[model samples]
Target: MIVAGSPAAWLDRAGYHRIDSPSFDLSMDSGFILDGEVYPGGDLTIREARALRFVVP
Candidate 1:
């Protein structure tokens, strides 16, 4: 996943290190499971999977 800004640029603004990973899973205490993903942190908010259509494309 591409960060909105570069790591150095993000660090300058947010003052935190960026974590990058290719794949991971997130399991909640309620037993919710998210699988087969990149950017697990960003994916955590997904409640369901759906196709995204872009008119410009």
Candidate 2:
């Protein structure tokens, strides 16, 4: 789960769960696949951004 947002965005440290995803290993820079969701703690400036940048690990 590669989340790219503003530097001010506070990432939820509560943690997340894992779900069954077939396309998991197909990615390069796959951070952590969360079966659940992440609630942003801070205000995200790029809330309306549609572009997603991923790192192929």
Candidate 3:
């Protein structure tokens, strides 16, 4: 399962120093396809800003 305050915070907290490319892969067998919601550990306003930067455009 993936959990973090935000995408950026997740990356920061997870120690992702650099993202060479703006893409990732998700295996089909991964669980929780539609079973849960992501909760940010910080303030709501800042969460989205931090998270969106990590998403590939």
Candidate 4:
């Protein structure tokens, strides 16, 4: 639900509980790996995701 002109957007945090997803892992306000690292923090090799924003990953 991207807004027309806003430079930033955020989803309601509560929406996570109401949605249905097949994904076994779910991320909250941050990416999934902050809970545990399959792709460890600061790793550049993993292109798919990062544990947090501005990380080397």
Pick the lDDT winner.
1
Model 2 scores a C-alpha lDDT of 0.40
Which model, 1 or 4, shows the larger TM-score? 1
What candidate 2 gets wrong by more than 4 Å, as runs, is: 1-47
Q: Least lDDT summed over 10 consecutive residues: which range in candidate 3?
A: 40-49
Q: Rate the local accuracy (lDDT) of all candidates.
A: 0.51, 0.40, 0.43, 0.38
In order of lDDT, best first, we have 1, 3, 2, 4
Clashing pairs in 4: none
Worst 10 residues of 1 by lDDT: 37-46
lDDT of 4 at 7: 32
> Clashing residue pairs, candidate 2?
1-32, 28-56, 28-57, 29-55, 29-56, 29-57
Query: Per-prediction RMSD in angstroms?
Result: 9.3, 17.3, 14.0, 13.6
Error of 1 at 47 (Å): 15
Candidate 2 lDDT, tens digit per residue, 1-57? 324432332334534433444332232333443467644333222223457999999
TM-score of each: 0.31, 0.16, 0.20, 0.16
Stretches of candidate 3 above 4 Å error? 1-16, 33-57
Alpha carbon deviation, residue 3, candidate 1 (Å): 6.3
Q: Candidates 1 and 4: which is better by lDDT? A: 1
Model 3 scores a TM of 0.20
**Displacement of the residue 19 alpha carbon in candidate 4, Å:** 0.5
